[model samples]
Target: MSGSDTVFNVKPGGALHGAVRVAGDKSISHRSIMLGSLAEGVTEVNGFLEGDDCLATMNAFRAMGVSIDHHGEGWVRIEGAGLKGLQKPAGPLDLGNSGTSMRLLAGICAGQDFDVTLTGDASLSKRPMRRVTEPLEAMGARIETAAGGTPPLKIAGGHLLKGMDYVLPMASAQVKSCVLLAGMYAEGETCTTEPAPTRDHTERMLNGFGYSVQRQGARACLQGGGKLTAARIDVPADISSAAFFMVGASIAPNSDITLENVGINPTRDGVITILREMGANIEVLNPREVCGEPVADIRVRAARLQGIAIPEAQVPLAIDEFPAIFVAAACAEGTTVLTGAEELRVKESDRIQVMADGLQALGISAEPTPDGIRIQGGQPGAGTVQSHGDHRISMSFAMAALRARGEIIIEDCANVNTSFPGFVELAASCGLNISQN
Candidate 1:
């Protein structure tokens, strides 16, 4: 669907029931493309994210001299170029709106002895590149970017990259993974300390693929110069994407939702913990392990939600899910306050300001902070919302509208196709009252 034609109009509830399975995990989907392309032999990935962002990584790898064949039925076969074997692309690689592709690939390109230009879609071009660029530059990679560390980054190779210690200013998986990917070719041990822990999929996947990586306390260290071997990876359903449904079932009157095959990696399970604390009856069942990541079935039943303060330390874990979380807060019994999360300002949009605006448009009282938003919970008076071209923003508030007083329409909803391609259909299947406008 074209971006302009994407608007979702959601009606009030048909209360949720039955178990629904989400698609592949977004984090694992990204790593599968990246690591598989650099391995020594053929790698097979099952349950990979077929969304635009992961697809951008696959296309970027193809342009960089990796042989990849997409056989029908969710299976991708990659004949890797081996570590240090990537060829320079013939022209500037376009990354669409995927920050994951640009950041992780920056490290891949830096390790090679070739020069390359990388550009992205308008949205990607605006996201801060410094998070990844700063760390790469510290490792002897030369990168020049637009003013204030935005994209259209020009990275020239040939510098001798020596791994060094880096302390992350914030919890960012992309930045952490970028440094680690470059460290794979560096001359010595590379280590990073975080202000708080972020998603550790890259670290775990590296270990699963036969690379020696160790994590201790707040630090994750990698022994540089190890070759990655091809391995099969099974991506669990994304907990981030499943958040909307969780919120939906939590707020919709008398609804009970079972979300199956969802990832419950501790670093990204803050939503569950926070929701459970808010008095939502959510249960995790059938816990299992896949490729070192925990997978579980989530069951959430509607209840009277009571909002509480979210700690600064937990901000990064639930950062991407906050917009929808605010929608959850709007229907809770008290006020929800969040802090220490300035990162939300630079996501697909200025999420703090945008979410505040959307909530106000819905007749829900919302206050904005320099870093976060505070939402006062009560019954919402319905109105149309603008997603600002953000997928999470589109689906999250749409769930909120399910229990709202009147009709709710989300404009510029095309971004949902980029991540959750069947969002509208899946919501409908879960007994949600939703449709595309």
Candidate 2:
């Protein structure tokens, strides 16, 4: 299986059971690489996600003179390049399918003394970059994107950025982090006010590295002159990755599963909140703090779900997990209405439209709204759905087979390695009758 040539064949009917730990947090993993590479000393990271996306981040830093040693099984050591130490790559830094790498690296590269270009695979090339570039531009960083603000970002270095108060046009952590990361090299204090709270991993991790990021209400501010000292990071299991199993165990009959060491970061736990609001049987166990982020064991069991309008406030919190959330809606007892999520339109795929089309193909009534979607709970029938090279969409539809009336075959599933690398094997271990070819 390679590229978009992979397909997933899932049989109807199964119950997910047992305790499993998913991959390390993708956002945290990405930030660890970025911050570690920029810090003053060797940063030892435990529980690093070895997914293609995060690895792409690692490779990008390595191309800039940072030395990173992979010690296998979720452990890595990074030799810092300091705030102004990244060298110009011989060519464009290929980030593969990682938007995080392209966006965040654009910020980091903006203050360097050498020019660099950031490129990606076909799918990532089509994703927008202006959200970060426009703001970085406002801060005096020179960046150029292709038409429609897409990827292949060429960021001109040696620009002296000056800190300014930035108001985010949307609730995007990547954009906020972009501005904040670029702020590190700016002339004064940099602050960003978001319309809604996003994952604060970058802010938290920055502070962990001896840099101070202040948060008051919806605003986060930091001074540009501070230097980052290296720190150890133990990434909790990604709640987004745990979400598939959570929804799987919630919807399937007699299914009960416990996910260990999952990060329940307040800003990123909307999926759990939404599912619970829809009558999911979920329990938060052994809640504690891990390196300034909250961690917990989540237990989810089968329940009869009744859908309601998803809270608009939680949209930013669970933005990435909506693909799986939509699957839960299809199996619920009523209609699930989602709005205030126009962000879905610009993800790896137009999630709202893609999920709606796939659900409709599977005999469910899913209407794609401009900002969100309307899903009518009903039984899913047999279908061949297209993932469109989107990993989350492929995995979401695979879980749909649990309540499907017949077998479900998902196309273009090879991108699952971008996030959850061993998805098929891990899914099978928990009783998901899935195979890939």
Candidate 3:
């Protein structure tokens, strides 16, 4: 399967059973490459995600004079160039379908001493980049963007930047991390106040690299000119990747599955919280810490779910897992209302609209609002759902097939490789009758 030609034929009538470990955390995989490239020594990373998005991040760093050795099977060694060591790339850095690479690299590139243009594939090219560029420019880094602040970002480097206090209008980890990465080269202390809590991977990883990132209330601050020493990172299984199976086991009858070594950082565990509140049976076992993030074994069993009003406080925490959570909502007994998630509109696709459309296509009632969605749970019928080049949307609809009355075909599923590579095989190992064609 290649590109848009890829499609998934998923049939109903299987209950997900047996244990499975999903791919390593995509967020952490990206950050490891970024931070490791800037550290002072060799940074060894185990369990790195071999997905296209993370590979794009690695390639971007390689373009900037960083040496990364991939030893097959998720182990990687990156020779750091230290701060102020990345060389000018010979051409525009192509980040493929990764918005994380483009956005975060924008911050890192702003602090460099040479000009670089960051470009991406069709889907990523359409995503707005001004969220990071605006703040980078505010800190005195020169940046030019496409019309309407889209990609093909042109950044003129070698500018001396001065850090300033900035309050985020929206809670975005990418935007926050972008400014923080640029802040490392700025002149003073850089602080970011969030309207709501976003993922703190950057802060956690910064601390692991021997830099100090202070957190007080909703604000996180770091000083510039701090050197990052190399460190070892064991990337835990992604909770977002674990979410599909969590919902699968939760909604399908006679299903029970355990996901091992899943990262359950308090900031990123909203999916578990929301599902448990909806009356799903989920247990966190063997809770421990791995590489500065919380890890746990999650056991989920099928339950009769009853939808409740999802708390607004959890919106930022579970933003990425909503598509799969929406599938769980469709299988629940009542209505699930979600709000304060307008950020979904700016994702790889407009997630709120795209998921709503896919759910409606599958005979579920989902109404899209400007900032949220209202879903009425019922049986899902046979239908073809478009992924809209969004990986989560494709996998979410596949999970929908578990409870569906008939077969469901998911289109444009090739993008699944961007995050969860080998998804079809893993889903099948867990009892899903899904295959790519």
Worst 10 residues of 3 by lDDT: 1-10
lDDT of candidate 2 over 1-437, digit per residue (tens): 35668999999999999999999999999999999999999999999998999999999999999999997789999999899888889899999999888888988898888999999999899998988988898889888899999989998988999998999989999989999999999999999999999999999999999999999999999999789999999999999999999998988999999999999999999999999999999999999999999999999999999989999999999999999999999999999999999999888899999999999999999999899999999889999999888999999999989889999999999889999998899999999999998
Worst 10 residues of 1 by lDDT: 71-80
Q: How close is candidate 3 to the true structure, as a TM-score?
A: 0.99
> Which regions of candidate 3 are displaced past 4 Å?
none
Clashing pairs in 1: none
Error of 3 at 254 (Å): 0.4
Q: Which 10 consecutive positions of candidate 2 have the poorest summed lDDT?
A: 1-10
- Each model's backbone clash number: 0, 0, 0
Q: Give the per-residue lDDT digits (tens) of candidate 3, residues 89-164.
A: 9999999999999999999999988999999988898998889999999999999999989999999978999998
Count of clashing pairs, candidate 2: 0
Could you give me the TM-score of model 1 versus the true structure?
A: 0.98
Candidate 3 positional error at 381, Å: 0.4
TM-score of 2: 0.99
